[model samples]
Target: MSDFATNARLATAALRDLFDPTPLQRNDHLSAQYDAEIWLKREDLAPVRSYKIRGAVNAMRKVRATNPAQQVFVCASAGNHAQGVAYACRHFGVQGTIFMPVTTPQQKIEKTRVFGGDSVDIVLTGDYFDQTLAAAQNFCTDQNAHFLSPFDDPDVIEGQASVAVEMLEQLGRAPDLVVLPVGGGGLASGVTAYMRAESPKTQFRFVEPVGGASLTAALAHDGPTTISRVNSFVDGAAVARLGVCTYDFLKWVDPAHVLLAPEDRICVTMLEMLNVEGIVLEPAGALSVDVLPELSDQIRGKAVVCVTSGGNFDFERLPEVKERAQRYSGLKKYFILRMPQRPGALREFLMMLGPDDDIARFEYLKKSARNFGSVLIGIETKSADNFRQLFDNMGKAGFSFRDITADEALAEFLV
Candidate 1:
């Protein structure tokens, strides 16, 4: 075996002491939908509810083995990585100091604390993740402690390869295609490297959030480069830049195989999995599955595996998710209407709505002229064609309106 295969196998064996291998189950729903043998590697079911635990455990274990006196570890994360490090620290009986952004959710903070118990300290410092990460690194250097990078380190990448080890072992044979979600590139690079060594014939596809496609940017630029802006809605996979170490491993990937998933469209997939398959996936976790439709022709009659990265979803965000899903599917719309300042005008508009059409929001913005007023309206209907019919009816009735559903700035401000 090559050095990478040996190390990856050893890492996988060590992970057995932490938690059982995550399930690799054939998904009937997806299989039928795409006419392919579809399987899901449920990394979401890991002890930390993510594959992050594998990297954390392996990295910490190797560090301790090399230097027995290194007892302190530090890391910065706002979600899964924080919990993974905390759990690993508790398991090894070592002290850990975790730094998180002040804007992190309370639920994540509490979960990290619970996992570490008395073995870790949580520090809420910066408003942004970059600020928190900088503070943590400075602290680690000042105290002469080891800093665990979320995905940039070699040990962490090798540890993450454990996922591919378990995947092949569970499936018993090489899958035709493996679809992976890419963020900082830890999981993708690790799995791709290991698979390339073990099953050279296997093909790979990578998915990234459209607004935070760092891997795509790296491949285009021939190196890791920072993106100016990132949409954090898919918080798990929304990285501004690909890590130098990870990019090196993934630099040879084909640009065509890297799929970009729109943030709103991912919400539609999340809702579908939750409602149909009884699977709860966070936005980032749904990335691989979200692009499956686009690959329908390519994936037909083949065996495919999608890595469901994590299920650390907060139910409080359900409403926002539903709204985005509806908007993306064209079942919901928002518009500003010019309403005549006359008696019974409201009733006239209300009568124009079809049976399936429901008013989700209505507000009179201003009565600027003596004969007309501005009104904001949000409508939800059963189909996109309903909006077309409604608009046609309104136009015939002398109603003028501007659709703001696709206008990000206007929708953010008014809706």
Candidate 2:
């Protein structure tokens, strides 16, 4: 076996001391939908509810072994990595400090605190992650503490490879394909590297959030590079830049194998899993599953595995998730309706509504013309077809309406 494959097995053995291997369960819903055998590597079931704990724990163990006196660990993160590090610090009885952006949600901060307890200290720093990272590094330098990188370090990468080792052992044989979600590329790089050496025939397809396609960017530039803007909705995988160590391992990946998943569309997958399978997945965790429909043809009659990388979803975002799902599925819409200045005009418009349609928002947007006033209307219905029927009826009634659901400027200000 290759050195990476050997080391990965050793890492997996070491992880058995920390936590049992995460489940590799076949998903009937996905299997039936894709007309193939679909298995999920449930990293979400880990103690910290993420695969990150593996890397964090493994890195800490290796560092403590080599350095002997390096008892302090530090990291900067706003999500899973922070929780992973905190959980490790407590488990190892080591002193650890974590820096987080001030804008991080209260729920995340609370979870980190609960996991670390007295073993770790939480530092609320800059508004942006870059500033927080700089602060953490500077503190590490002054305190002579070991900085546990979220993805860029070699030990962390090796630790992540344990996921692949466990997968091979659990599945018995290599699957035809594995779908991995990418952030800074730690997990994807680690899994791919080990699989390439140990299971040469296992094909891989990578998924990244559309707003933060760092892996694709790195492949394009042949190195790690920062993006101008990144939408942080997929907080777990929305990385602005790929990691240097990770990108070096992944630079050879075919750009065509990388798929960009739209941020809003992920909401539909999250809801589907939650409602249909009684499984709750954070946006980033659902990435691999979200791309199933896109890869349905490629995976048909084959065996596939999807790594669900995290489940640290905050229930507070449920309403927003449902809203995005509704919007993406075309079940809700916003539009402007021009109403005549007559008194009964509103009543006449109400009568044209479809049975399944409900008015979610209605406001008079006065137009400059004295003869007519514009009304901003938001509608929620059972099906997209309901909107078509409502539009047809309005057209026949001589009422002019414009769909502003997709108008960025209008929807932002009004919807």
Candidate 3:
């Protein structure tokens, strides 16, 4: 075996003492849909519901073996990584201090505390992840505690490679193609490295949220590059910049092989997996599967593996997810209408709707002059094409309206 494969095997063996290898199940639903042999590496089933625990456990193991005197571990995370580090700290019986952004959801904060138990101290600092990360690093230096990175560390990357080891063993063969989600690139880098060494025939496709395409940005620049802004909709994978160490291993990846899944489109995938397959995936967790449709032709009749990286979803976000899905599917739209003040004008406008069209929302803004009044209207239809017909009818009927469904600024204020 190659050196990387050997190391990954060792890491996989060590992890068995902590948790069993997560399932590598053939998903009949997705397979039939895509006409491919779709297997899912259920990293969501890991102890901390993410592949992150693998890295955290391995990093901790290596650290304590060399220095038994190391009693403290520290990290900064807004979600899964913090929980993974906390769980590892408790398992190792080491004291841990986790720094999280003040804007972090209470559900995540509570879960981190639960995993770490009395072994951890939760510190809510900074409004954003960068600030919290800086605080964690400075505090670790001041306290002489070992700071565990979410990604970017060599030991952490080695730990992540264990996923590939497990996948090969569970599947009894290397998959023809492996799809991975990209965030800080720890999991993707490790899996790619291990597979390159152990199963050179396997091809890889990387997925990232469109609003946070850090890996694509890195590939475009020939190195790691920071984005000016990132949409946090896919919180698990919305990394502003790819990690340096991760990019080192992934720098040669072809930019074309990296697919960008839109955040809104990802929400539709999340809801579909939940409703159709009864599989609940967080936005990042759904990344690999979200891109499956794009690869349908290429992967037809081939054995494919999709790593469902995490399942740390909060049920409270379901409404938001559904809303995004509706918007993306074009089944829902918002519009501002200029209604004539004539007594029968409202009735005339209502007559333009198709039988399948339903008014989801309607409100009238009064006008002092009485010639016309502003109306905020929302409509849901059975078919997306119905909107074109509805707009056409409205135009011929002399009703003036402005479609605000795609207007980000207007939607934020009114919708």
Candidate 4:
């Protein structure tokens, strides 16, 4: 076995001291829908509810073994990584200091604290992750504490390879295709490296949130590249820049093999997995499964494994998820309509609605004229084509309207 594979095996054995292997169960629902054998590497069932614990435990174990006196570890994370570090600290009886953004959800903060218990200290600083990371690094230097990176270290990558090791053992053979979600590229890089060494015939595909295509941008430029703007909707995988160490391993990936799943479209996938399959997935966790439809023709009748990276979704975000799914599915729309001020004008407009159309919102924007007023209206329909028919009927009736649902700038403020 290669040195990396040997180390990964050792790490997998070491992980048994914490939690057993996560399940590699075939998902019948996804398999039937996609017309292929679908298996989910359920990292969501890990001790920290994510595969991040593998990296944290592996890195910390190596550091402590080398320097037995090194009892302090530090890291910066807003979600999974923090909990992973906390859990590892408690397991190894090491002191940990975790820095997180002030805006991080209370559920994650509480979970991290619960995992670490008295072994870790939680510090809330900065509004963005970069600021928090900088603070943690500087503090580590000043205090002489070992800093644990989320995905940028070799030890961490080796630890992450344990996931693939477990997959191969559980499946008893290499899958035809392995689909993984990419953020800083730790999991994808590590898993790909392990698979390439052990099962060279396996094909790999990487998925990332479209709004935060750090891996795609890095591959396109042949190196790590930073995006000026990133949507944090997929907070777990919304990295501004790909990690340098992780990129080194993933640099050989074909750009075409990287799939960018849209943030709103991911919401639809999350909802589908939850409602239809009874699986709750965070936006990042659903990345691999979300892109399966795009790969339908290529993967038909093939054995495919999708890494469900994490399930740390907050129930509070359900409403937003539903809104984004509705918008993406064309079940919801926002428009500004010029309303007639005369009597029975409202009744006349209401009569134009199709049987499945329902008005969700109506608000007066401004007075357009002495006999007319501008109104903002939100509508939900059973089908996307319903909007076209409604617009046509409105046009024939001389009702002027502007669809604002697709207007990003205006929608941000109004919708």
Candidate 5:
């Protein structure tokens, strides 16, 4: 075996002291849908509810092994990475300081504290993640502590490779393809490295959120570059830039093999997994499964593995998830209706609706005209075709309306 592969196996063996390997289960639901042998490496079921713990544990363990007296470790994260680091700190009986943005949800903060127990300290600082990261790094330097990069460090990457090692051992053979969700590229790079050395013929497909496609950008630019904007809906994987260490390992990946999952479309996948498979996946965790339909043709009759990266979804976002899923599936829409400012105008508009159409939101907004007023309306229907009939009927009745569901500015402002 190659040195990297050997080290990955060693990491995997040592990880038994922390937690057992996560499940690699055959998913009949996805397998039947794509006519392939679909297996899910259930990292979501990990104690920390993510594959992040693998990297954190590996990094911390190796650091302690090399410097037995080193007891301080620090990291900055508001999500799974923070929890992972906290869990490792408690397990190894080391002191850890984790920094998170001030805006981070209370649920995440509490979870980190619960995992770390007496072994870690939680610092809430800065309004944004970048600011929080700077604070954490500065503190790390001041304390002479080991700073764990969530995905960029060599030890972290080696620790992540344990996922691939366990996969090979669990499946007893290499699969035809492995679909990985990419954030900072730590898991993808580590898995690819070990898989390439062990299962030389296996192929890979990388999935990134459309709004934060740093890996695709890095491939195009020939190096890591920060993206201009990132949509934070898929917070777990919404990374603005690929890590330099991770990008180096993933540089050989073809740009064509990387797939982008739209943020709204990912909502549909999350709902499907929850409703159909009784699996609750966060937006980032659903990335691998979200791209299955796109690869249906290529994966047919082949064995494929998808890494469902995390399940740290807050139940409070369920309503928003359903709304986005409905929008993406065309079962819901928001529009600005130019209603005549007269008696029984709403009744006339309601009369045009089909039996399956239901009004979800209705608010009258006074626009620049006195004769007519604008109504911000949200409609949900059983079928997308219901909206088509409703629109046609409204047009025939001389009622004019503008669909604002896709109008970013207007939707953000009024809807």
Candidate 6:
């Protein structure tokens, strides 16, 4: 075996002291859909509900080994990374202080504390992630703590390689393709390195959230570059910039092999997994599989492995997820209706609805004049065609309306 692959195997074997390997299961549902043998590397089922624990545990192990006097580890993260570090801290009985943005979700904060128990202190600081990270790093320097980076460190990358190690052993051979989700690129770096030396024949497709296409941006520039803004909807995989170390390892990836997933389109995949396969996937976790439809022609009749990176989904987001999915599938729409200022106007509009159509929302904004007014309406139905029929009926009836479901500015202002 190659040296890096050998080292990765050793790292993985040592991890047995922590937890067993996550499952590599053949997903028949996805397989049939794409006409391929689709297997899922279920890192989402790991102890911290993500492969993050692998890197955290391994990084700490290396740190403690080289510096026997090291007792405290520090990190800044809003979700999985914090939990991973916290869990590792408790396991190793070491002191840890984690930093998170003030806007961090309560569930994530609680989960991190729960994993660390009394071994870690959760520090809520700053309103944004960049500011929070700065505070953590400065604090780490002041206290002489080992700052555990979520993805940049070499040891963390090695630890992430453990996933590939387990996959190779489980599969007995390399698959035709490996689909990976990239955020800061720690996991992708490790997996890609191992695959290069060990499973060289296997192809790769890297997925990034469309709004946070750091890796894609980096590859295009031939170096790491910061995006002006990033949408945080795919919180786990949304990064404004690729890590320098990760970019070094991944700089050679072809831009064509990188796929960008739209946030709303990702919601569709999340709903599919939840409803059809009974799998709960966070937006980032669903990224790899979300590309299947786009890559259908290329991946057909091949062996493909998609790594479902995490499942730390907050049930509170379920309603939002459903809404986005419905909208993306064309089954739901929001519109500004030009209603006649008559008492029976709503009744006339209601009569235009088809059998499967239901008015999910209806509110009169204000009366403009004695003869006219405006209403905000939301309609949901069984099929996209229902909206076409409804619109046709409205046009014939002379009731004008504008669909605001896809109007980003208007959706934010009103919806």
Candidate 5 structure lDDT: 0.94
Clash totals in order: 0, 0, 0, 0, 0, 0
- lDDT of each residue in 1-415, candidate 4, tens digit only: 7888899999999999999999999999989988999999999889888999999999999999999899999999999999999999999999999999999999999999999999999999999999999999999999999999999999999999999999999999989999999999999988999999999999999999988999999988889999989999999899999999999999999999999999999999999999998888999999999999999999999999999999999999999999889999999999999998999999999999999999998999886678789889999999999999999999999999999998989888887
- Model 2: per-residue Cα lDDT at residue 129: 96
Q: Residue 75, candidate 1: how far off, in angstroms?
A: 0.7
- What local lDDT score does residue 221 receive in model 4, on the 0 to 100 scale? 89
Clashes in predicted model 6: 0
lDDT of 6 by residue, 24-99 (tens): 9999999999999999999999999999999999999989999989998999999999999999999999999999
**lDDT string, candidate 1, 216-272, tens digits:** 999999999899999999999999999999999999899999999999999999999
Candidate 6: list runs displaced more than 4 Å. Answer: none
Q: In model 4, where do residues sit more than 4 Å from their true spots?
A: 367-369
What is candidate 5's lDDT per residue for 223-293, written digit by digit as tens? 99999999999999999999999999999999999999999999999999999999878899999999999
Q: Is candidate 1 or candidate 2 better by TM-score?
A: 1
In model 2, the Cα lDDT at residue 217 comes to 90
lDDT of 2 by residue, 1-415 (tens): 9888887788889888879999999999899988999999999999999999989988999898888888899999999999999999998899999999999999999999999999999999999999999999999999999999999987888899988998998999999999999999999989999999989999999999999999999999889989889999999998999999999899889999999999889999999999999888899999999999999999999989999999999999999899889889999998999888888988999999988999999988885768888898989999999998999988998889999887868887887
TM-score of 4: 0.98
lDDT of 1: 0.95
TM-score of structure candidate 3: 0.98
Sorting all predicted structures by lDDT, with the top scorer first, yields 1, 4, 5, 3, 6, 2
Cα TM-score per model: 0.99, 0.97, 0.98, 0.98, 0.98, 0.99
Model 2 compared with the native: what TM-score?
0.97
Each prediction's whole-model lDDT (CA): 0.95, 0.93, 0.94, 0.95, 0.94, 0.94
Report the Cα lDDT for candidate 6: 0.94
